[model samples]
Target: MTFALVRVRRGDLRLDLESFARYAGVHPDLVRRLVALGLLEPVRERGEWWFGADQLAELARIERLRRGCDLNYAAIGLVLDLLDRIAELEAELRTVRRSRPPTGGAPWTRTDSR
Candidate 1:
């Protein structure tokens, strides 16, 4: 529900494929593999890929899921999709709750018929 904002230095807003891989401390092949698997999405210009802060964060998240949960890439994709859906649902729920009128009692009251 909470997110941390990262500040990008001047001229560091976007990175080329090599720079992205170096910044992420991973092999270029790995990055390419992730892109192939649709795990990481980067902008392709001409014949090269350009990565932004979002890709970096997503790469870190993917690594964490892979290492922490010991899941394969396919399974990780599923987990990521589910997690994204959950986050969307949570946000919708919060918005709905905020717009709702407050009731200073139980959510439901039972009525008995004689």
Candidate 2:
């Protein structure tokens, strides 16, 4: 995850569909397609969909995966899921490592002579 910074207008944490598309530099129809494909989740309010500012990061991630890996939406979804799982596992491993006492030498040591 390299530096990806998104600037949003202050005091506007939610964006309408069109605004969301514009901010992402894409067409609204593409946004709709993403929504249909379950890649983007928007909240329905008053029959209109609103997306959180945080979704910009998700959109960027989707584009990165699509371009970098040349993947379709469905494959992108699977890749994102796997990436998330890997991150979770890494965090868990860090936590476990921190909780355990360090061995005097390597983690694996033979206690029985051959």
Candidate 3:
């Protein structure tokens, strides 16, 4: 997959709901449902609702999981949880490997000098 870099405001980024919906290739009403489910955070401006890039990214993830894994929202949540746990474990494994010493520096000897 390709990734793009975009700049946003210092404190937070905001996009109109229409823009966010288009980015996610979903209907505005469906986006509203996701927002209602507490999975997305809405930005308010004079009673208007906007969404952030982070929220868009999350929706994209959910969409991918739904289409690729054929999972419902509940199942998606569980899969995300397990994937997060796996990532954490992988990170820990990397840290442990980095902290260990190399084992092939010296030649092996068969002498018993105890």
Give all TM-scores, in the order shown. Answer: 0.83, 0.80, 0.66
Residues 1-114, candidate 3: write the lDDT tens digits: 222222356877676777677767788898888777666778676787777777878888888999998988777777777887999999999999799886544435535442
Model 2: lDDT of residue 28: 87
For model 2, the run of ten residues with the poorest summed lDDT? 1-10
Query: By TM-score, how accurate is candidate 3?
Result: 0.66
What stretches of model 3 exceed 4 Å from their correct place? 1-8, 42-49, 105-114
Local accuracy of candidate 2 as per-residue lDDT tens digits, 53-100 = 768889999999999889999999889889999999999999999998
For all candidates in order, the CA lDDT equals 0.84, 0.83, 0.75
Candidate ranking (TM-score, best to worst): 1, 2, 3
Per-residue lDDT tens digits for candidate 1, residues 1-38, read 22222335664577788888888899989999999999
lDDT of 1: 0.84
Of 1 and 3, the candidate ahead on TM-score is: 1
How does candidate 3 score on lDDT? 0.75
Cα RMSDs of all predictions?
6.8, 6.2, 6.7
Instruction: Output the better candidate (1/3) by lDDT.
Output: 1
Winning candidate number (lDDT) = 1
Deviation (Å) of 22 in candidate 3: 2.2
